[model samples]
Target: MHVCLFDIDGTLLNTGGAGALAMERAVGELTDGSDRPLDIPYAGRTDRAIVADIFRHYELDFGDAALRNFLGRYVEHLDEMLGQSPGLVLPGVERLLAHLHQREDVILGLLTGNFIEGARLKLRHYHLDAYFDFALGGFGDTHADRDEVARVAFNTLKAHRHPEQIDLRRLWVIGDTPADVKCGRAIGAKVVAVATGVYSSDQLAEHAPDYLAEDFEAVDELLELWPAIG
Candidate 1:
């Protein structure tokens, strides 16, 4: 079987600025100062890393208990903000996912930097969660490194589907960042990089992903990367 792992944030849908706003609000509630900047890069970074960065910036404790508290607040705010400013799903994502779902040989899963609940919330809001097999992918809580997440995904695939040896050649990681391309390479998997995120097509092409596209609008072009189904 061919396994495809997809990233959530910019690859499938844009969550407006809900994620950032949520984080800012969460930190503001937890911190003493209202003027402290909570700015941090989100692209290709895990929620765990983002939270850690926040704690580091503000010189707060990054212990498990503190993280839990902060994340709880962040999630709560995220849920609320998402309800108000739920972003747009990119071009051709829904149709492509539906088409891939019908392919017997293709196993669809998510490889995102979002916490499991956060990932679910975003996908559920957009009505796209049904396209993925939640039991067979990696989440941000696992590790800060995208490559580590890919390893976790491979392990999920092995435990759930392949009892014996699995070929890495059949694995594909699809996302819209250079980090996505790098992580895909880290696992010896082919990457299908999109230009739907902050990065342009030219920028993503510089990373030399196995497949590069402006978006998921062309189902046929994407299907070219997959093996023929029975």
Candidate 2:
């Protein structure tokens, strides 16, 4: 079987504006003064890291208590904002997912930086949750590092599938950022990068992913170019 691991934020959905707004609100609440800019980058990064950067930029203390409170408020209000203005999924994502779903050899999983609950909320908000197998996902809660998350995802898939044998090289990580490609490379997994995020095609190409494309519209072409799995 061939396993396909997908990234959430930029690859599957576009929650950039809503996410920034929520983070800005959370930071504003944490610091009474609005002078601190929440200019932290979001693409290809974990939520924990993003929050930490925000705290650092604002010179605010981020103890466990503060983090917990911020997270609670952020999640609650983020959900509301998403409900009000849900973002658009990338072109051909729905069609590609449906095509892959019908294939017995293809197993769909997520390797995202979002925490499990946050990941679910985003996917569910976009009505894309049911298409994925959550048991195979690796979330930010497991590890803040993307490479560690990739390893966790591989292990989880192996444990769940109980494959007679596992071949690490057969696994594919598909996403829209160099970080995603780097994480897959860490585990010797093939990476397919789509230029739908902050990075351009040339930028992602500099990372040397196994495959590169504009979007899922050419997924079939990508699959054709990928080496056959055992």
**Residue 213 C-alpha lDDT in model 2:** 90
Which candidate comes out best when scored by lDDT? 1
Q: What is the lDDT of residue 187 in candidate 1?
A: 78
Tell me which residue pairs clash in candidate 2: none
lDDT digits (tens) for residues 1-230 of candidate 1: 78889999999999998888888889889886466755689999889888899889988888789978988998899999998995999999999899888888888999889989889889998999899989989898858888898888878988998645356777899999998998888878899999999999999999999899999989887888886856
Candidate 2 Cα lDDT to native: 0.81
Error of 2 at 122 (Å): 1.2
The parts of candidate 2 lying over 4 Å away from their true place are 63-65, 163-165, 225-230
In TM-score terms, candidate 1 sits at: 0.95
lDDT at residue 151 of model 1 (Cα atoms)? 84
